[model samples]
Target chain A: MPDWQELVRQRLSGLALDPSEKEEVHVELAAHLEESYEALLKENVPEQAAVSAALFQVTDWQDLQRRICAAKKRGHIMKKRLHQLWIPGFLTMGLSIVFLVTLQKLGFNARIVSWRDSDIFFYAPWLVSLPFLGALGAYISSRAGGSRGTALLASIFPALALTLTFLLMFPIDMIIEPIIGRQADFKIVAAALLKDGIGWMLFPGVALLAGGLLAHVLLSLRPSSRETAIG
Target chain B: MIGSGIKRGTAELAVLSVLHDGPLHGYELARRIEQQTNGALRFTLAALYPMLYRMEQQRWIRGTWETSANGRRRRCYRLTPAGKKKLTPLQREWAELFHALQRLTKVSHA
Candidate 1:
């Protein structure tokens, strides 16, 4: 009754949302206002009072505009994160997993070396393949305007994932031992973790991260890739 | 009347609970909440829409355009699987708070 659509458009104007998104908000708000106004009218309220009461629902139009605009903009940020970090990270992770599986299937036994009384195991083929996977992740992330940190992170996803798994394993095992009626010796567990982690997590993580960092540094040198970079 | 401060904390629960029934457009959704609370709780247009948008972005709820029986087009919102999953923890927390408050108030009144 109060030309609610026009009122909404005028009040919510200058929002930094896409044209279609702004229109969608305008229509929804106008409909809500219209519903309120009509419901008030049905209760024998005068036209002017109904309009006034309906409009009073929003105390600060400026704040409303800011909030709606910010909410819609955050949706865009999620999309950007998907492309810049998640997609690249997953792709690199998948590639490395595939490479590792192939090497295992080919009977490429992990070469064992005695390092500081630890039987350190290294899959030669998979370890060699990491530099390329790291490069792929870093290159893809930077091209998509990822920040230096995310690009580095994407490149070393596999190592990080392995490290995360190892870290979780310690806690999970500790929890389960008590549940399964066994006493977990904390000192023994820590010593075993330290000895095993040096071989399984630290060495591979460093190698993979080094490859990723090298590619990230090379990409950072290019001015075009640096322009849209965000952390 | 419930204060905005109190409502702000429970708004997600209110919206998600009301929407758990089925999809409803913005106006109907607001009306349902107020009705369920005996008009003690009302959502202003300013407060409701932004929270709705934020929740949709979070993937807790999904919105879609629909033409109702009266042929008015509006964006209908429905609870997602994620929203349903979130409801259990929220309900548990609120129940625990209510019990704690009841205990404190009884002690104070004594």
Candidate 2:
């Protein structure tokens, strides 16, 4: 009888699977062939006929190999994308929160409220860091097979979070205003909020756009041979 | 021989129905499916294994290694709760499809 395990390993050699995964497939195929061969022999079949019958089950090994490798590659890419994009994005957001808390502890809030000449100084630090954070998110997303839209969205995660928080807090602030019996210029507060929101997002948005353009240039310059050759 | 398109569509239902009763290794599953269908539905290893792996990935079925009485190790596949949940709807769809085909063909059931 032919060495079924060796035959299975040879047939599966073209697959791009990891070594352990390939070995598992090899064992499964070999075991399948062995069982089929034994079952045929039990029915009084000759050894040569049994071997042929067992091998006949794998009618198109090439097609099988192609499909298996394609599936494995897709799985690998998805896993890589999840790790590369989401993990770093969340970490960056967490670090930004810590930086804000540190600023508050350093009495930055008291200085901002006492502003006599300029309001921009209150947000200068955040503005300076926003572009780098956006660039980091865009770079990670680009490296993980994300499109331009994905890169932009990833970089704007902090903005999205801040907007969502403000939306949720707006109702509570309105309810507490009458209870506190404090009336301030609503128009001025609204203007400042709008201005600050725009200021906070301006650098990050520009950075994301620049990062996306840079990614596009870098990608187009690379050779196309790295892409999958098979359909 | 069954056409590849129809075979592919029905393969999942057939495997799930057979495995609903108990777990079976690859060889035994093939043998039982062929035997039960009177050779009408046959699965080549190349076609069957890939589908099995895909379903395993989907959490529809789980495969575990077990040693037979003869001390030979085999990977036996059993239907999961998820697979069982999906089986009823799949069977219903196939029945509906069969009825539609029968109606269109104007052929009475044999």
Candidate 3:
């Protein structure tokens, strides 16, 4: 009676569903709410109270949206997973790697400057766009109902991958160097590689994490009732 | 008041038992359940609808949009063959649970 359809449609604005399917849901739910509201009114409840009571029948619209999506898109969930989770994840990682590779191709070398009695790798050039890219990825992941851990992981995948590379591949590289007749000092080479790994892990990683944190701040309104309450 | 955890366990059975009689829209189904249970099994719209959608998706129930006698459109849900088949086992399970609780706590079901 009170434009329940419009009210429902507004409440469920970001439901990731097709128009027709969503419209069907909207109509069905609106009708149910209207009926309940009318019934409450028949019981001599005030109009505003009846409206509130009917609205309170669905305390968590976001959960309803997700459950409906899960039920309706059971088969399509894998595709949706690819859309919501993997797409953003890969885009962030891909962009980070591409930018780093581009810097290498462009002959941009990192300078090691001593700071606070420790040699530090200065790579401010390639790190310029990383925060923005990371933020975009995190924002997309958040919009897709990803939690802080998943969103952080998606945004910082580049740094994590580099960390893994350093942890695993560096050891293998160290082992293979001797067989290749490169008589580099093991202690010195290990130290340098460790420093390099820490550098890559620290600066770019922090920038990306900063981006993820930024997304969290900017997306303060992001967590639906489902996310905060259920989770 | 029943805990939500317990209510969730019987939600499907409650819905199926109600629909066993005949087709009803979402609102009618919810109201009938609350009334029949003497308001002990009140279901929120958030709880009822997603389960309804899931049941429909599983081919246990079918929903058809129809015009009511009052000329208002309603989506009425009727039990499918699958739904009818499922009800017996669910009823048996609830019966077994009640019997077990009775044996344990000397509490009889109404």
TM-score for all predictions? Answer: 0.62, 0.67, 0.54
lDDT of 2: 0.73
CA lDDT scores, all candidates in order: 0.85, 0.73, 0.82
User: Which pairs of residues collide in candidate 2?
Assistant: none
lDDT per residue for candidate 1 within A1-231, as digits (tens), equals 678999999998887776888899999999999999999999999999999999999999999999987877788888878888899889988998898889889988788888777687667778888888888888888888788888888888877787676566678777878797886665465556566775666766676677878888777788876675544
Q: Flag regions of model 3 displaced more than 4 Å.
A: A75-231, B107-110
Error of 2 at A86 (Å): 2.2
Q: Rank the candidates by DockQ, best first.
A: 1, 3, 2
What is the lDDT ranking, best to worst? 1, 3, 2
lDDT of model 1, residue B96: 94
Where model 2 places Cα greater than 4 Å from the true spot, the runs are A72-77, A98-102, A109-231, B107-110
Better of 1 and 3 by TM-score: 1
DockQ of 1: 0.68
- The positional error of residue A42 in candidate 3, measured at the CA in angstroms, is 0.7
Which 10 residues in a row give candidate 2 chain A its minimum summed lDDT? Answer: A222-231
Residue pairs whose backbone atoms clash in candidate 3: none
